[model samples]
Every structure is written in C-alpha cells, then in structure tokens.
Target: MSFSASSPVSFVRAAVDGEIARFLDRRRAQLLEVGSELVPVADALEAMLAGGKRLRPAFCYWGWRGAGGADVAGIHAAAASLEFLQACALIHDDVIDNSDTRRGLPATHKRLESLHAASGWTGSAEAFGRGAAILIGDLCLAWSEDLYQASGLGPEALQTGRVPFDAMRTEVMAGQYLDMLEQVREDGGVEATLRVMHYKAAKYTVQRPLHLGAALAGRYDDLAPVYTDYGLPLGVAFQLRDDILGVFGDPEQTGKPAGDDLREGKRTLIVAETLERTGSADRAEFLRHLGDPLLSAETVEWMRGAAEDCGALAACERRIDDYVAQATAALETGRIDATARSALADLVVAATARKH
Candidate 1:
C-alpha cells in the first residue's frame, strides 16, 4: 500500500482541499454583491490557500486519530479550518514584513497595491494595499470560526475544540506583536528569540492544532500531554529550518526572495546565535546591515560566510537534529494509539525536514 493509504494526514489533505474549494466557491458569488471590486479580495485568499503543504491540518487530523477519533467527513472539515487560521497569519505577516511575494507570486498586499496603481486610484497605492491586506486577514480570521462552527460535528466535539481554537488565535496574535517588538529592540538574544518561536511557531503551528484535534476526539486528556511534548519541539525545529531557508534557501523553492529574513532584520535564533559566536567586528558589521531594506547581495554573502565560519550554522543544525529526536521519542509512549503513532512519525519528518 502507498504510505498515504495508511496516513491520516495524507488522506485529510486531499479531503480538506476539496472542502476549502467548495467553501470558497460558494462565498465568492456572495462576496461579489458587496462590490465587484471586492472579488479580488477573495481571489487573493484563494491563491494564498492553494500552495501550502497543509501541515497544520495534517497535525490536527492525526491528533484526532491518535486520540481514537474515527475518520469522518465532519472531522475532516473541522481539521481543514486550520488553514483559514494559517491564511490569516500569512496575510498579516506579509503586510508586516512588506513582502513582495509569497508562494512564487505577488503577495496579497502587493497584488492589491498593483490593483490600485492600475486603476488610477487617488490614494497612495502602498497604503491602499496595506489596508486591504489587513482587512483580508481579518476576514480570514472570521471565516475560520465560520468553518469550525459549520463543521457538522457533535456539539460536544465542537465545544471541546473551541478552547484551543480560541487560545491558538490569541497566542499567535500576541506572538506576532512580540516578533514586531523584537525587530525594534537592540538586543533580543537567544532566550528572547526562542520565546517568540515558542509562542509563534511551537504553540500556534503545532501544539494547539494537535490539541484542538485531540479535543475534537472527545478524550483529549488521553493524548494532550503527549501531543504537547511532541508538538512543541518539532514545531521549533520546523521554524528553525524555515529560518535557515529564509536566508539560504533557493528562491524558487522557498517562494520568497533570498535573504529576505536578514533584510527584514528578523530576530531569529539563527541570527542571535551568530552574534554570540562571531567576533565583535563581524557582529558590528552584521548588525549594521541587518535591517537594511536595500542590503546588497555581496553583503549578505559576507554575513552568511561569517556566520558559517564562526560555527553558528553548524550549531543550529545540531539543535534541529536534537529537537527532532525529542519530538520523535514522544510518539513511543505506550499510551498513544498504535495506528496513529506510525502516521505521526511520518508527519514529524515531513514537518521538520523540508526544502520549503
């Protein structure tokens, strides 16, 4: 049998994709009544949702299965609602970062900005794009709840998932504020940076999704602890890999410009570690160019070299391996459902070990 045949996540991804498409198709016409101009709003959302690996939904699906929930269509739709939450984050994040592209195309804000310019709108195109994108993000956040409420699960099941669903959204928004704060502070060191990762990626990306799924299964207490232990470390490793990619990944594969993170001056663990490992001169130069919007390729290359030469890059890689090992070990606990355990093992690898 194919690996997917036995994998809850693999099956749910396909199902969830169909559900989202159907949901958007119905909403598109309704939204057009507000204004024909608003059609592009939904268009940007559709495009953003199209290309992700659906990792959040995967974790949620397996979390439910691991907690003994059966594979039902209602649960699949509930699991798929996580993507709408993710879309909210990405749209707002792109606006905050002033990113030009996402998933190899113009970001939502950029697309809206282009729309303004092409139509001879009277205001600043940049301001219009930013405003429109924020509204889009808010709409996605609202629709996430709509999807969850309309998921057709039992009342109790929906109630169970609601707690984590609420917590996840609140925590991520707080984490996003922290991330913006870090960029402004002169020093956010490893400890502070990791704090952002924990709230932003660890909790928002994995732990809550898994908990939300387990809650939907009706006996979250059975697997909640195990899922937390597994999810947090794995989530951090996933973001760490993303940090590596943000600086060094192939632009085509990552769907963003090379060194975008460095250009934006994100206070990632990788950058923090590099400062600790490198000498004062290299550190000074790195900081000077860290947030430069017009940072040059030669300067980025030099900074990358400095980080590598100081052994920071190798250390970060080692940290990723260590976390992956911890996350994998959590699945071995005897309390876990056997079939779901195997699927989650595959998910651990998929979540952390990716080119994107």
Candidate 2:
C-alpha cells in the first residue's frame, strides 16, 4: 500500500498507507463477521482507495513537521483518517456526476450495478447500485471519525486537531452543495466558480489539512495564517490544473475520458472563462456540446480548438502559474522550518502540475 515519491514527506506518505492498510484490515474482518455479502463493500472501498497520490496526508504531515511535531504512529493514523474522508467524497461525487469509471475501473455505483445484474437480482440494478454506493460513502464518512478516534493521540492533541478536522468536513460538504447548485443554475461566472472552488476543494484539500497538522502540534494559533496563505492558493491552482486535465488530459494518464468534464456539464473555471470570452453565437455553439454525454471526439476537438482560439485554456495556465507563485511567496514567511519549507515547495509542483 506504500507509495514512493521523491518528496520529503514520502516517509510520512508510506507510514500513512501502512496505517490505512492496518485499519482497513480491521474493518474488513468486522464486515465479514456480519456476512460474506459485505465483502464487496470492503472490496469496493479498497479498490477506490488504490489510486491517488496521497497528497492530503503529505500536506498534513508537513504541517505537523513545520510546527515542530515529532513523527509518530498517532499522527500517521490521524493523517490516514483523511483518506477515508476523501474516499467518501469521491464515491458520492461519482454517483452525483454519473461517472462510469474512476481510476480506469468501474465506479463504485457502476460496479455494484454490474454485480446486481450478474446476480440476476429482482430489484432495479441501477437503483441498487446507486443506493449501495451511497451507503458505502456514508460508511466511509463514519469510519473517518472512527479512525481519528483510534489515532492513539492524547486527548489534548486530538482535541486540538479536531477543530480543523471538523471544519474540513463541514466546509467540504458546503462546497459540494455549492458545486451542485452551480450545476443546477448553470452559473459559471468567475466569482461564482471561484466561490465554489474555494470551499469545495481549496480549503478542504489543502488549508484544513495543514491546519489539522499544526493543530495537532498545538501550534494552530501561531501557524494557521501561514498554512492558509500557502494552502489556499495552492489548492486553487491544483484544482485549476484538474479542470484543465478534465478537458485535455491524456486518458491513459488521467484514467478518465478526454473532455469528460465537458460531458458531465461541469461548470469549471475553464468552461466559465470560455463562455465569457466567446461571442453570443460562439457561446451558443459551445454550450451545445458543453454537456453532451454522447459527445463525439470530433466535437471535443472542436471545443478544444474553440477554447484555444478564445484563450481560455491559456488563461487557466497563466492563472495556475500565478497562483503557484503566490503560494510560493507565502512559504517565505520565515515561519516554517527548512525541511517543511523544502517539502512544501516540492508539493507545489505535485499539486498544481500533476497529470491526474
């Protein structure tokens, strides 16, 4: 379960994976105690957890390190808890977006649906799959809290970290709701899109993780601002890169079809900017294919071209570069240690410039 990276927090990343593996093993055994029918629930969760760069845990580790916290099993378990939370978000998000695949495999809901069909179940397979996936997400959410409680940290330390832990959960849900609203309202302005991105991903993915780490170290009051200064812009840049990859990234690398975001009717910054830049007639043409589920490769290419001609893609790239710069500047605040500073610098590239 370990992931090897050149970053300074690679050791922490491996430790977090070890923690997650051991925790899941316990969970799997408990599930089996109920019945063999529950094995697929464990399997789906493990499969979904198999991918990802483990970015969040790394940030949390560095946050702790920056705040002068020692490396320990408790922190690793605490960081591992974030992975369960992430799993909850991803599973439910796939259901909402009707994503067929994740990480080159059938999404949780689709997997359950296929199982229901193969078993010749009597009920609606689609509904069964969706319902099962939703329950799995709920289970993951509950398990996140369970893992946190089992982290073995003292009451004081756990209490400190709980602030950001709780805030991250609440903010992510709020952000997700805003994202849902954006999709429903077809709101894609810079302001609306950024507002959604900020709460949904920016704070949840980066800021709060860092805050969690610092909080556990009992240095939240001292380091909270620095974490935010670095985390917020970096998170936005990371998601902006994700938006670009959603549109133009290689399928082999991203594990998603090219232009999948467009097909899903995502009101991403790219789409919003493109709409703002195009003439009314061009906007109409672009909107026609923006969310076409059966969208053709030819049309995707045209939209790509249109986006390029309108400079929306280039504009996003520029913003990514600028935001990365802002995040980098925040690191020079003379608050973080040398090791944490250097590792966080490496993360800027990992977060904002990743392929998947």
Candidate 3:
C-alpha cells in the first residue's frame, strides 16, 4: 500500500520502499545474466525487503533533516541503504535463530529448504538452505555498501558516513556472537541483557543509522553525540518491545509463531527477571522448557502465566516506559530541526510501542 498519505514518516517509508524496489529490480536483472538458477537469491532478497516499517530509513532521514540537510533524493537513497543492511542482518539472524518465518512468511532459509524438498534435491535440504541463505545475506551486505556509496552524496560526504557504516557492520557481528554466547551460557542477568541490547539493537538499529545520515550531511562531528543520546534509549526500548512481542504478541501481528523467543532460549531481561522473582518451582518449570524446541502450546501459556505471576512482564513494561521517557527527553536537545524533532518524538512512541 502507498504509505505517503499517512504521515511524514510514512512519506519517508514509501520513498525508501520505492528506492529499494528499484535497486532490487536492477540487481535482479543483472543476476539473470549469470544464470536462471541465481534468480532465487534476488527473489529471496526482494521478498525479505517487501514488508517492514522502514524505521531505520525513517530514523536516517530524520537524522539528516535534523542536521539541517536538505530534503533530497540523495538522502533518501542513503537512508534506504539501511534496508539492505537490515536484510542482511535479518537473513543471517533467522538462520542463527532457526526462525521458521519472518514478516509472516517462511524465512529465506526455510523457503530455500522447502524449495529443495519440493525439487527432490540431491543433498540435505537443511544444509543447502543454510548455505544459500548465508550467500544471500552476504549479497545483501555487499549491496548495502554499494547503495551507500552510490547514494549521490559527494565523495567527501560519503567518506564521512563510511566511518559509522563500517563500524556498524563490525558491531553487529560482535553483537550476534555475544548473543550466541548468552544462549550457550544462559546466565547473564540485566547487565548482560542491556549490553547485548546496546550492541545488537541500540547502536546497530538506531544510533548508527542516525549517525550515517548526519555524517552524509557533513554534520557528524556536531550531531553524533546528540543522536546517540536520542537513539540509544529509543533503540533499546524498541528491542524490549520486540522481546515482549516475541512472547505475548499475536502471530498475525508479530510475523512469528508464539513464544519463538522462549523456544530459542533467548536470555532476555524478561527471562532474567522471571528467574529472579519466581519461586523455586516456577523457576524450575520455566527453565525446563526455556529452550526446548518441542515445547507445547500449553507449556508456552504456562510460562507466560509464570512470567506474569512473578511480575517479569510488568517489570519489563516499566523499563520500556522509562526508556521511552528518556528518549523523548533527549530529542529536546539544542539545535535539532523543529520539524525533525517533532517527527522523531512521534517515532520514539512508534518504535517503542507497537504490535509488530
């Protein structure tokens, strides 16, 4: 649907979508010359990009605008580049999480697995699926860089943005490793949870995107700290909302099966708080099925009950509320464009409080 009529953010979202679609169409045509078999990679990438709130681009666009950058086609393309980066992260994340679906459709790896099974491929469908997904994720990462470079900014401006762009990729990879380590160890409490959120979600999702936009507009030195002040809290709040949705949100809205995070044994603040507050029996029950792939719906509901009974859900909600307050406060910092500030205030709410 055309989101241009909804709001300023929606206009940015629609513009970003248009840029991404054009980029993918161009890429798909180029891939066709390689081989028909290669077309599925583009298809997977296209499908993955089709459904998202475009929040990263929205943040980037507003960041640029807040930095006194003109509203221009170049900034839109630059902002849209975050979508490709996000695609890379999502494809790789789904593989690592063993997620079956994303954006309410089979994940890239899962889709490939089904394709292999349907075609009666000669090898293990699981392995083939994973391998294909890895390559596709890499392709998206590479394309993200290309689009960033070609965002129509001058060489110096692109170079300015490159600093955060490079750092973001590195930080996200490290964050993913830390996340895996948390799953394996399964004992980090609130501190660990916040650290993971900082790298994995906060910086990568919001701060860096904002920095990239500001940098491209030649305002990095002045605005980087301000963006961080605004972006980090909002970003963490965004992920916390995601964690809540992973447990409590409807499948129709969240685009994942119920309790998928619980199935994955994510060491979220919710899990940590529940463990801290529950009685021994309730804690044991939660731990018993914390990471079980075979957890029944009844067990999932039971865990949800235990979380609520122990006040973990309420605690998480309180934290989100505080972070939202902090984020909204940060936007009032000196010298930001008034229009951008207002839109960003709206974004703080939209990012932190949502069904999906």
Candidate 4:
C-alpha cells in the first residue's frame, strides 16, 4: 500500500483501516495464547478500532510525502499505529467523564459493566466495568508503542519518530487533566478552554502526527515549523467543529447523545463564549443546567437557543473560519512539494467540516 501524494483521502483511510485490522488481528492471536479471559480485551479493542475517520494517519502519510519520502507500505503501518494511542485516550476519557455512550454504543465501561452483570460473578458490576475499562485503556496505551516499533520500519526511522510520538501521549494526558480541572473550577473561561483544546485535541490530533511522519522521513528539522503552521490552526478548527457537533448534531450522526459535552460540563470554547455573551440572568440559568446528569430534551433545546441568541455559536464559527484561513495560507506558502501540499489541502476540509 504505497500511496502517492495524489492518492484520495478515502483511499488513505481504507489503507490505514486495513493495516489496523490486520495488526490487531495478529495481536489478538497473541493475547489468546495467554488465556481465553483476554478475549474480551481483544474484542473490545477490535470494536473500538472500527469506523474511525483515520485523520491522524492521513496527516502522517502526507507529511512523509511532503518531506520527499519514497512511497512505502511501512509508512502506512507506522501511521496506523497512532490509532491505538487515540483509542487509549478515548476509552479513558469516557470513564473520566462518566459518559453513557460513545459512537452510538455503550461506553466501554458500561459494556463491561453489563457483561459483569450478565455473568453474575461480581460484587459490583459498575466497579468491575470501570476497572476493566481502565485496564483495557492501559493495554491500548502499551500496544501503541508495540505497534509503532513493529510497524515494519527500520529502527532508525522509529527512533527518529520517537520524539513526537512520546510528546503526543504526554501532552494529551496533560490536556485531559486540565480539562477535568476546568470542569471543577467554576470560573473556567475561554482562555482555559483554548489551552485544553490545543493540547488535548489540536496538537495530538494533527501537528504531532505530522511531525512523527516527517521525522521518520529524516526531514523533521526542516519541516517542523511548516507543519506547525499548517497543523496547529487547522487542528483547532477541527476540534471546534467537533464541539459544535457535540452540542447541535444528530445523535445518529454523532454517535453520542445530543448535548453530551454540555452534560459533561466541558469547558469548550463554545460554552465559554456563550456564557460570556449571555445576559447575567441567562448566564445564571445556563450554569444551573450545565452539568445536570438528568438534563431534559426541552432544556437542551433551550440551551441551544440560548447559545445561538448570545452569538456564541456564530462567534465560534467565525473563529473556525479564521483558523482555517490561516492554515490554508500556510499550505500555500510553506516549503512543501506540490503533490503533498495538494493532498494536505484536501484534508483540511474533511477534518473540519465532518458531521461526526
């Protein structure tokens, strides 16, 4: 699966998905050798691995091409390894937020809890579920390293790519903690939300993946700033788009309940801006409903109306447009080859404009 820079985004996604599936299938066999109890572990991972948009790998692949790397299947495998890290982050995030569902299915903890209940061998199904999910998240984190090292690339390439790889994991964890802290801090504002968004989603989701690929191609020193210019703003726009969808998207499209982010009381830029723009009375009302576990459909609609009326949603949309403009300009002026630049330019729309 040696992809040219001209390869379609859909093609890249399919290739990475195939690599992930094959890699996990091999790992699943190895796990079963230990015992059948690990079957659930493998099954859960496999399920989680399904149906992602594969944006990280797409960025990585194009980054390699931009740096004048040869077309190679090994790069695809290395890029696909990032998916495991993403899975680890998502599983732990759900548990931390006490989320009910993900991608239209039970959150991993809830599913494990259900299994515990069905088996009738647990003191507390909820506890068992949470414990199992935590362990599984840990397992995915470990496997991310394993898959990257064994991605069929040489040791030198893997070693070269290690800096961004390690940094990405560390930053995402730190960002997630900051987000949790913001939830507790009653006066969380737009600046705090922006910081959390940058570390947790923006850099991890884009910049670092690009850096990892360029590093592997031996051009990291030259391309680092260019990648940052293109990736950072675009990544922020992408996450902002996601935040919008989390609040206003259809459940069938987003795979989570409507207002899930609101329910979790995430300090998203949208929420922060909306709070700032609302009248004092309306702001007070918003806070009362912010993190209510039993929030109602009617109230969710009211919150949507409040967000719109306050101009927060429009403001956020303008911010996304501005960031995207910045990134698009970077793509034009940056020192990247034509084919790779075109490929990357194609990705900007897909990343920020997706429904889910």
Candidate 5:
C-alpha cells in the first residue's frame, strides 16, 4: 500500500524500533560484560538513537518496495541497518562539529563530559569526553556493520549495497576534510565551497542512500542514473535548508542555539555568496568575524541581513526550487511500483519542506 504524508509515520517508527531493539538485545551480553563504566556509554548511545525522522531508512524501505519486494522481514531489517549507520554518522558528526547538543539533549561528548565532571575524578574533562565519544562512535560504526550483515540480504545484494555504503563513509570524511580545509585556507572561493557542499552534504546524504536502497533491491544498474538525477539536487537543497536553519531556526525546535553555523564559521553557500557579492571592506569585516565562536546575537543578525541583502538567500531559494524540480523530473522517468513511487514522492516533498 502507498503511504502518504498523512499516513502515520508510526509504521516506519515501529519497524525501526524493532530493529534497534534487536540490535541492542543482541549486544546486551557483550555490553554488560564490558564493565560499569560502559553502562553510561550505552546509555548515551541509546539517547542518541532516540527521536530521529528516520529519513534514510525510509529511503531504503521505499527503494526496496519500489522494486516490487513485499518481504516485510527483509525490508524492516535493512531499514534498521540504515538507521544504525545514520546513528554512527551523527555520533561522529557531533564530535567533528564540537556540537553541545542533539535532539534537545547534551551531545554524546557533552554528556560524557557531564558524567566525567560528576564523578569528580577527571584530569581533563574535555579530553576525556572527546576520547570517550570517539570510542563510542567507533563502537556504533562496528555495530552498524554487524546489523547490515545480519539483515538477511543475500551475498549478491550485500555486496552491491556495501560499495555505496563504503563510498558514502569515505566520501563524507573527505567532504568533511574539504570543509575544514576551506575554513582555514586563504582562498576558499565560491567554487570551492560548492564543491565541498556537493561532496560533503549532497552525495553522501541523499545520493548514496538512494543508491544503496536500489542496490539492495537488485535494481542497481537500472536505478543508478535516477539516483544521480534526483538525489544530488535534492541533497544539495536539503543541506541548504540546513544552512538556513543553522542561522535562523528556533533553538527550541532545531535543538541548537540560533546562528550556530555562523559561530562555527561554516563557509556555506549562503556565506560564500555573501562574500562574493559584498564590497572589499564589508567582505573583510565578515571574514574577520566569521569564525568567532563568541559572536554576539547582533553580529549574527548583521550577517543575516548581509546575506539577504546580497541576494544570497534569494539565490539559494532559487537553487532549491530548481533542484526540487529536477528531482521531480527524475522521479517521473523512473519505473517503480506505483504505490512505492507515490510514497517516495511524498517523502521528497516532506523532506524538502522541513523547517528543522
């Protein structure tokens, strides 16, 4: 049956919940045997797994459904694997961004810091937290692989999906490095920034997920181009929406302080366009303050205005619209089960329309 936006997201949630529960249950013996200290780590990991939109898993499920698979068992297991992979990514991403929160709670590292401080036996709480979070991320990565292996995909399907998953991890790391390098380099221009966006956010987030889903469904050769045509533009738009929220979203809703991206000095497309459009003096002032972690609200407001005034916001909106249109066109051309295609169409709309 086709799912609608109005359809309860509960069905998807239920599937994911089962998968995660099974994952944790299978690891319970190992986790318990580790020691008392590891309990908190497990708690932190569980917290990170709570309350995500499950977008990637939805993509995987629908991709399989689209290929005419009615194997509920197989689809549910694969979806859970996607969620686990996403968990791994988010844990590491929080470490890389030095973010303090996730889903309205302390981030993994920050939570570890709190635990370290509460224990009253820390030399360097910050270092301890970072090191602990790294290990936790590594554990999640390993568990994600285990879940994928246990998902019951045949050897052929497993081999096919592994390629994109491997590429997705490798490319995201490279893209992240490119982003960090852009922040430090003297000559990070518009082109360089866009390249980073495509690699870091676009390809890994959307393209690879779609490809992985299709590959698992035994439609890799036929569905590859469709993924490229649809996933790339939509992923870029998704990240651009994220950039907008990073600067302008409500903290209560987005689970982060407003203008967090500015504080981090993210050289996003909006920022890049603002720099490109501004005069030399204004550009220099922006450059000087872009990466200041202690930037005031007033300064953030000023940067927001500059972005809007320079047509950066408008340009981004135009690009988002163009990409959405391209994705729609790609969907039109692809042959998939009618019900599954409709569900995916709904997903595309809802994903692009999200405010946080």
Candidate 6:
C-alpha cells in the first residue's frame, strides 16, 4: 500500500484526473436531462474543473496513505471530492477578484460575460456574467457534496470526513468575507491581514485537506494534531510562495498577468511586511498603486524591487524555510510507515519548492 515519492505524485495525479473526468461526465448527462437551458452552466462547471494541477487531491491521497489507509478506490474518490470543492472555490474566487483567466483559459465569469455580450442577451452583460458564474459556482458546490457522498466510504468514514469538510467550508467562506472586508477597512493593519491569510488560504488549502484524508483513514484522533503540526506551517509557506509567484512568475506558466495579486490587493503576509518596512514616500506610492488594475510592467518591477529592498522578500523566504523545517521535524515525530512518511515529506518539499 505504500508509494514512493516519484510514483505517488504520478499515481495521485492520474487517479484524481480519472475520477474528476468520470464525475463530470456523469453530471453533464444529468444536467442535460434536466433541461437545455442548463447546458451553458454545465459547460462552465466542466471548464472550471479542467487543467488544474490537482495538488489538493494529492495531499488528500498521501495523507490517507500516511494514516495507513489501503483502499485506493476510497482514497481516490475522496481526493476527487476535494478537487470539486476546489473548483467551486476557484470559480467564486475569480469572480471576487475579477480575474480574467485561469489555467491560461478565460475564467468562468469572463467567458459568461463574453457570451452575454455576443448573444445580445437582455440585461447588463456584467450582471449576467456575475450571476451566471455564481450559479455555476453553486452547482460545483452541490456536486462536490454529491461526489463526497458517493465516494464509497463506509458510514463510519463518512461521519469522520464530514467534520473537517463542514468546518473547512464554513471557515473558508468566513475567510473570503474577511478578505473582502480587509481590503476596504481603514484600520485593517498587518495583524488583520495575517489573520485573514490563516483563515482564507492556509487552513482551507493545506490543513483541511490533511484532515479530510486522515478522517477517511479513520485516524482522526492520531493524525488531527499532526495536521496542525505539519499543515499550519506548510500552509503558510505555500501561500507565501503563491504570493511571490503572483507578483513575479512568468505569465505563461502562472496563467495570469504579472502583478495580479498586487492588482487584487491581496492582503498577504509579504504585502503586510512590505507596508511595514517601506519609508513614507515609497509606502504612499505603493499604497496608491497597490490595487490599481492598470499597473504597468515597469511599475510592477519597481514594486518588486521595493519589496526586496525593504527586506519583505528576504523575510518571506526566511519564513518559508522556517516552516519547511518545522514540517520536516514534525514528520520525524509522526509514527506512520516509512514509505508513506517519505511520500508526505516529498510532498512537503514539492509544495514549498514550486516556482508558480
């Protein structure tokens, strides 16, 4: 039942992709049978599920293996369910951030907006797009639940998985609201921003996946604390890396414009640090241009240099390394099988080492 670092990554990817395709195919037929009018919505859902790297599913699979679960079918289904949840989140996230692209394709909202405009649909194109995207996101959420219910886990496993899923969804929604609130609040300082990052990105992205995987393996009592020990620090590192890539990664690889995070005014730890360390003039300039969607490449380069010059990037790197070390140390404390532990450790490295 154990997997090597190299094999697990590939196996997890294949399993998740297969499960997602199967789920989508079945759901597409069901939606079509419901009515012709729901076709676009179904297509949007499928598109949103397309072309993801499936990292969340990998995390779930490895976590289950680490907890000594041997049922590949059960683990695959659970992992696929996580992907569905992720699709729901991403679709809504793009709408909230007003992002135009995902995975190098038009975002759900943008695609819907384009269709509305081209078809000369009655009502404002923007409103129609947002409404359609919202419905698509909701559909994904419903399918997420349905898929999880059909994961073929026993009743006992379902009881365990439900706890983390419920908490994860609730906390993520709250985190999303908090994120929006932070962008507008005059008094939202560095602390507030960090809190939002923990709730919105860290816990939901890494911690919850680990918890769900462990729950599926019926090792919640033994592995829940391990999630805190390993997931929290790793989750933070993951987001810090994401923030770095959002501002600096190649647009082709990241599937978004450079400085997109800056344009969205994401209240990341790096941004908070930059705000704290920069001088008054530079700080004023940064604040003025922080969320301006019209930012040029030159301005983004300047902001990047400013972040490095003010020690924000260096500090963020140090923090990432610290978390990586913490996760490594926690792995030593865990009593999982050596092979499973090795796979999870490799995952920690892979997740944190990515450039995009």
lDDT of 2 by residue, 1-356 (tens): 22223465566778888988898999999999999999889999998877667888889988998898888889889989999999999999999999999988999999999999999999899999999999999999999999999999889999988899999999999999999999989855978999999999899989999999999999999999999999999999989999999999999999999999999989999999999998899899999888889999999998888888999999999999999999999999788877788888888888887788
Every candidate's lDDT = 0.88, 0.91, 0.88, 0.88, 0.80, 0.83
TM-score per prediction, in order, is: 0.97, 0.97, 0.97, 0.96, 0.94, 0.95
After TM-score superposition, what is the CA distance of residue 19 in candidate 3 from its true location, in Å? Answer: 1.0
RMSD list, candidates in order: 1.6, 2.2, 2.3, 2.3, 1.8, 1.7
TM-score, cand. 2 vs. native? 0.97
Per-candidate clashes, comma-separated: 0, 0, 0, 1, 0, 0
User: Whose lDDT is higher: candidate 4's or candidate 5's?
Assistant: 4
Compute the lDDT for candidate 4: 0.88
User: 1-356 in candidate 3: lDDT tens per residue?
Assistant: 11222265686987888889888889999999899998777788889999888888988898888899998988989888889889999999999989888988999999999889998989899999999999999998999988888888889989888898899999988998998888888778788988999999999888998898889888999999889998998899999999999999998898888998999888888888899899998888899999888888999999999989989999999999998888888887877888888878888877876898
Model 3 C-alpha lDDT versus the unseen true structure:
0.88
Which scores better on TM-score, 4 or 5?
Answer: 4
Model 6, 266-337: lDDT tens digits are 777778888899999998998988988888889999999999999999988998999999988888864665
Ranking, TM-score, top scorer first:
2, 1, 3, 4, 6, 5
What is the per-residue lDDT of model 5 for residues 169-202, given as tens digits with 9 covering 90 to 100? 7888799889888878858877898799898888
Error of 6 at 243 (Å): 0.6
Between 4 and 6, whose TM-score is larger?
4
Worst 10 residues of 2 by lDDT: 1-10
Q: After superposition, how far is residue 126 of candidate 3 from its true place, in Å?
A: 0.9
Off-target runs (Cα >4 Å) in candidate 4 are: 1-8
Name the candidate, 2 or 5, with the larger TM-score value. 2
Off by over 4 Å in 6: 1-7
| Winner by lDDT | 2
